[model samples]
Target: MAEQGAAERGPDGLSRRRLLAASAAGGAVWLLRGTVGPESARAIGTAPVLPGGLVPYQQVYENWAGEIRTSPLWVCAPDSPQQVADLADWAAANGWRLRAQGQRHGWAPFTVAAGTPADTRVLLVDTTRSLTALSLASGFGGAGGRAVRAQTGASLEDLLAFLADQGLGVAACPAPGDLTVGGALAVGGHGTAVPAAGETPRPGQGFGSLSNQVLSLTAVVHDASAGRYVLRTFDRSEADAAAFLVHLGRAFLTEVVLRAAPDTRLRCLSRVDVPATELFAAPGSPAAGGGRTFADFLASTGRVEAIWFAFTDHPWLKTWQPAPDKPLFAHEVSAPYNYPFSDNLPQPVAELAGQLVSGSEQLAPVFGQLQFLITKIGLTGDVTDLLLAPGLLRSLLSGDTLTHLLAGGLRSDLWGASRHLLQYVRPTTLRVTANGYAIHCRRSDVQWVVSRFASSYQQVLATHQARGEYPMNGAAEIRVTGLDDPVACGVPGAQPPLLSALRPHADHPEWDTAVWLDLLTLPGTPGLHAFYREIEQELLGLFDGTRAGLRVEWSKGWAYTTDAAWADPAVLGRTVPATLRAPGAPGWDEAVATLDGYDPARVFGNPFLDALLR
Candidate 1:
């Protein structure tokens, strides 16, 4: 149910079931049925009196994969912070719960749980429609000090663009550009980054998730004296600020002020030639001697990511380095989303994806290979691939003209501002569901983390393939970033986000870096839940906090059973809380208590948050 990526050949990047249903006789009407506009907003029976001067409408909810959909329900768009507060008060008074709705790019039920009926007493506060405001804050220390004050509805892309205009930017951000700033902070969204050898962070810069940059945040909280919810601002120095920093949608944030540093130019290089065996080889092994191992790139440049297609030998590896000026022979980019081949599907890939949607499960191998081939040709613009394959493979790859047509230009190497290179994922890419985790370990053991994950994933895939169950038809994505460090915010008594996955373990001070791993596949693929459950078990045992610790990424899927995600009672009740906070530690319990103290009536919580947070 994640909200990311899209396609044109089918509905939102060819969702398998949707595509099949779309191609069926008289199915187009079925697909178009129930789509309503704001003008058609309706209230169910016995609707309570809404706040004056505010309009309520019926809106359907759908996540990125269209997995968690709902019938038309109540929604509202508040134009200002005070209006949002008014809505919160109205919800509390009228027996309704308020859930902030951003772009709906997330997979988890942080916004609204599945199977929620049309008559439920839940009110969705649509932030993106209004309340988006961005400006620079002044008078921190002197003129050199910089910070951006943005409303919750402001998008990451717009915020980055604003900073870029002033030669100020954040150190890292997630790949997709459409995410709301409030949503990103709520789930502790992060990007791949860490300091290189002998590298020191500049003022106002931190190599952690976006939530770590908060200088202050304004939220709606219950006020005991007022006997209702009221708008309150919490500084990073306050003890209660820790809980609000990454509240996982249990709280509502209206605005945030984030520290920004001077923007740096960057050069990005793409290589689809490295074999997975060498790239993910054992640490210090001879196979990893070619200076192309993942660790080697991380050591030299400190910014890297790998996308390994299923059943493929070579992985598409990308490395980013600080480049003060555009490197000679590097393509200069003017904006974000430069990789057209990735943003849009090529002809062969679209055809294969259509076949997959048509229930041709045996084509998983062909689909994986085809994806890799398209990447190779699209990245380097090398048409020499036509003769490299035989039989059906050659026929499929023979359309070099179509590949180049889909890929606007060769993008093997590029140079630009950090945002252009850092944010490459666009909304037009294929939409898929992903299971995510952050593995905490010492920087020296990053190689071991990658090696173990790669080996275990191969074994799992082989087992499923042998049993004729092609559960995965997508790639394995890997990235690394530094853990959250409160000192980087340059504020005295500032506290780190207590619930953040990157929050440094109190007992394990040596764990400085977090390796982010995600398995991506189209939703509703057969046996995906069981496969994810096995992978989760393997990961929990492999890391086990002895050498490394494992935690779930709040935005993606986790806590899997045989049938679904976020459904395992043991994980939801005990393991997840224990992973975040030890029995005697000052984390999970403190966060839950602080949130409850702010919203004692649980007016801001959903069913999922109610069960998990407790």
Candidate 2:
């Protein structure tokens, strides 16, 4: 990776992108620009005055899992939308390419990639600083929720916290709060929500990925009339707006209006007694399991997630239900990241991961079982609050709270606001490489999807274990979501997000639900890539390319090879495009063409994106 000072000019030796990565120190002020620390190898050329101060590129960029690394020419942090427009225009006028970097939490190369030098004239836009704006609409009369406007750089945690203060909440959100709005939407990040048992979706929003809530977005695009890159707002009503809605990072969004609802109280329960064989049984297997099956939970609550520890019989099942008020036996919480055992990486687990990554590949199973035991203890230990330390709990309450603990009449249910409970895992917690896929199928077929996939997953793992190739480190996650409704955009004639994993199946309208499946393992673990490839093959094999199919969870790892992620040429060049171009699915070629029209010079693209869009 190349390192250099900020460019005072464009690629033609002028100030195009005053790119500067945001510093963790002294956030909002952003007065002291990032100077070239010891890592930067080159100095940026001479430049004119830019909005953000020019300094050497000193930031060392690493993805969340520390799997990918790259040094960009400059980390440009624009203070305003106008500044962004100017920088983009100048970059195009020259020959430099720009890639936006949010929290640097994602595995994909959408922003910047390893082995790419900074001197290649590429700029990484750090939006976390000045771009943190969150505003709510006022003076509107409607049955729907309020429309909130947020900048692309706002972290989900900050955005969620602000919304909590405003008495508003979102439909669904990923677990980590450190995820940036731009990065999340660029990759269609989602959480579990499927209309929660007859609850109607708001007029201006739907129960899908974070992207479906978008009403209008502003981005820097080439304007022939203006003869330069300028800030342009696209409403859902426009045809081309569909392209920007989910352009796979091919286009950039500065700010967007997201529809939000009044905050609601939620109850979350953790169940760890269900066996994998019964919980994930075939769609119509049998009713003899005695206990409720995964399908039963989905039908009853509509919000369920199954996290099965590899090689373990009882997978942890989490079910969330709408509780208008505190239940008789509910525990109360006011903040997030409540799961201490998960939010902060455990020392033993970290050691296991270190060993697994260091070449003790056979220890994968042992590490996974240990993790499962810790989770069980985390949920049911003497202090059920998993997070509350013994000393702190005793200090908070000396008598009644302590006596109740002794009596064993402690609470059984967790009661908290949606925002607080929905966001429990903090960033840098349990950093590991993972593969994710969302399978769209009929709600009735969810059991089949889960059962079949689980069966195939276990079979593959066992076959590999026989060959001494321990590829799994324990748990797999399963979640569900409703298809994105077109009307959610609030545009008179808008369509659903073109590339969202929850996008509907055109032919079989009954296929409106999606089952999200994910496989997790320690990064750099031997045989992980090949192991994930086998799982990917199993998932794709079960879909059959008809009424049911699979879409990659873009923000996460995918396109697996024997040794690395995003390295499968066939999956990139053919599988993804062909799947998107299926009979019922919308036009892939058309979306690519529309995006190309938006930025003729490919200003916001990279080699990986070019392959997918091409």
Best by TM-score: 1
Which ranges in model 2 have alpha carbons more than 4 Å from their true place? 1-56, 138-143, 201-205, 287-291, 382-412, 582-586
Q: What are the RMSD figures for all models against the true structure?
A: 4.2, 8.1
Please give the clash total of every predicted structure, in order.
4, 16
Model 2 misses residue 584 by how many Å? 8.0
lDDT score at residue 594, model 1, on the 0-100 scale: 99
Clashes of 2: 16
**lDDT (tens digit, per residue) of candidate 1 on 1-614:** 22223532333354554443332222232122233434543445444457867777777787766677776677878888988888888888878999998878889999997657888999888899887899988755432348999999999999999999999987789999989999999999999999887777778878999999898999999999999888999988999999999999999999999999999988999998889999999887898889888888899888989999888899999988888987889999989999877776655565565566455767788878877877877778775664566566667766564556445787889999999988998766776789999999999999999999999999999999999888888999999999989887777888889999999898899999999999998766778899999999999999999999999999999999989999999988988898888655569999999999999989999988999999
Shift in Å, residue 374, candidate 1: 1.2
- The TM-scores of all predictions, comma-separated, are 0.93, 0.87
Candidate 1 wrong stretches, greater than 4 Å: 1-48, 142-145, 397-407, 583-585
**Which pairs of residues have clashing backbones in candidate 1?**
2-64, 2-106, 3-105, 7-13
